[model samples]
Target: MSFTLPTPTAAERNRLARLFAQIASDAGTRVMEVYESNFETRTKADYSPVSDADERAEEVILARLEQDLPGIPVLAEERASREGVGGQIWDAFILVDPVDGTKEFIQRKGDFTVNIALICGGYTVAGAVFAPARREMYLGGGAAEVFEGFLPGETVTQGQKLVTRAYPPEGLTAITSASHLDERTKAFLAARKIAGQTAIGSSLKFCWVAAGKADVYPRWGPTMEWDTAAGHAVLNAAGGVVTQPDGAPFVYGKGGEGFRNGPFIAWGREPV
Candidate 1:
């Protein structure tokens, strides 16, 4: 059966955002456990690396999602890699990337994250991203109700509300992917008057822009919905925008493309 739950109210969206943050924190703890251990890595059918941390953390996220928000479909990375999500359009669903930035996780770079997002009507309505090793958590929902917090235990506390900064007159500070920087991305940056750039793995690029740590993030390479949905939601709530190269709205639920994502640019604020 197709699951098409109605979008939650603004109050409910904020509540779900916090709930997602807690869930991401729980999954992140499991990821950290695997990170600290002697973990084994294997290559997926697509030749991308998958580690025990990915699977273990996904287990936590899936279990929690099932308990907290039952009946909603979940499109998770690990499970999707194993059992492909058939071509079924969904009006609403959850996207989970239990251990985003596996390369960073494998390299012990501490840039990996646990991501959970709620997508409704082809938009990311709520999301949470937790970087356990960095002790950071970000949540977004409602209109401009984005927050960043520290997770000391199972809860996220002392949340500092976040908003995207205005574009600086000097130039843009761009964030790029550490592992997937392609020529098209390089060419895109080369054309811009960039003041500085930082390369990081996973969804942190979107969070950096949302937090106003950077002005833009341009990815010309391939990504999956689970890779961008949560971060996109956080950025959107923080007064940022993510769109196509031509400035079109970036949308989700591309079941025809097998949930794969096209290149998109995320901006802290529109440049003049």
Candidate 2:
């Protein structure tokens, strides 16, 4: 079934979309500002790279969301591990990844983005992905928008309507993390004999699939809910599936345990 964002009226949907787009754009600005600056990169405890942009972008996104849509739970990457915030057992809430491609941003590749997803019940009702460095914004799936803006933060006029491509003949083209590829994914690929592959950073992996650029993404390495939530929502709206290997739906409220996601695959349709 096609997914849809929950909104009382077209006006309300448009209003929320505009606000979400702006918040994404602002977060993009904060990220780019740090991108332009000479910031030192540090390895996290797990050896994944992080920068000032990551923290700043989360701050910007969270601050605006709190002001703009208070009372709704916010499950942010940075705050997800904190004592009182990460365990989001909300009937409705926002899931955000402030700076999705920290590695690409650090490498100056400009493939990063600000990802936001709104969840209703246990599913992604709507999602927005803004790739600032590229000056493109992709929305819809459960909710429909494709837009390009002239300036870094100009108005996002709509573009082509996007949908996930049909599944591939020789199995799907899968995208994986640049830094976190692990044995489980390798084994899955080997056992499945999936040949085509691409490596990407941040939530753009999900955006790629949502935009019909790729068909699958399998992550076997460590990931928190925030790391996948926004992208998961985007994929979900785009006629895709993001599920635990056990065949259970990936639910939130995992608590402040930080890394929680095991291996999961996202695809245009359910993979055989």
Candidate 3:
């Protein structure tokens, strides 16, 4: 697939931001409507959990993105394969995870999120994770200071900033999915001698590192590009490393190829 234009202008940027924010907020509304309800969930062929909330939220996202940014292509979770959109090595694309932490959402754990990322030149320039269940949004990139805005309330000022908690050395606090931590990730942590671990869901794992709430996140399980792009942008903006142990920077636009990342780490500071 051919790449789109370069970085968007201030006006265009704001438009995209607002569109994404609107979609995310709408998704929140859709999810919260059923957050406490008895929405049914079913197992995918791979045994992954999915609910109507996921499909509905993705529909809202796809509609808004297509209407607002017609030129830009969307890689939404539900539309990935149906659209025949994942094979090409495009220069730019919109990566979306309509409902991450589906298990958390299903269990009413309030850790689910809607993750969106702008991938260009094989890197995430703008990413946002809206935890609608918790009414918190982690938005970073496009400028300094990872902004954490509480929902239906205040907003982030253009100039004021937030940075990661200083990287810790006493013991690394790793974050994992409460219900989805796989055996490979567990073994990797155990063999690598990670000092401690905590469990949360969705892109919050990346936010944990960005906010200095935690130090590192190691995962060996299979993850689609949407799952990490937004979080990756936030962590990178906060002066953190989202790279392989071999020291190469994480690159996107690989689709189902390019190793899709294996046993990588998101560190708040230099590894010891």
The residue ranges of model 2 lying beyond 4 angstroms of the native Cα positions read: 1-18, 42-49, 80-88, 148-151, 193-195, 256-259
Expressed as tens digits, the lDDT of each residue in 190-222 for candidate 1 is: 998899999888898999998989999999888
Q: How high is the lDDT of residue 249 in model 1? A: 86
What clash pairs does model 1 have?
Answer: none
List of clashing residue pairs for candidate 2: 140-143, 142-237, 146-159
Q: Please list the C-alpha lDDT of all candidates, in the order they appear.
A: 0.86, 0.71, 0.71
Candidate 2 structure quality by residue, lDDT tens digits, 9-91: 44454455556777787788888788888998987655667788878888988888889887777877656534445343566
Model 1 scores a C-alpha lDDT of 0.86
Question: Which lDDT tens digits does candidate 3 get at residues 1-272?
Answer: 12236755434443444445556766767777777688899876557788888887888777877776677767777666344453577777889888888888887888888877788778787777778767676666644343345552234334234366664546677887666688777775776546677989888898888877788887766777888988887787676878765677778888667315455778887754
TM-score of 2: 0.83
Model 2 lDDT, residue 261, Cα:
64
Clashes of each: 0, 3, 0
Quick one: best TM-score, which candidate?
1
Candidates 1 and 2: which is better by TM-score? 1
Note each model's CA RMSD in angstroms. Answer: 2.5, 3.9, 3.7
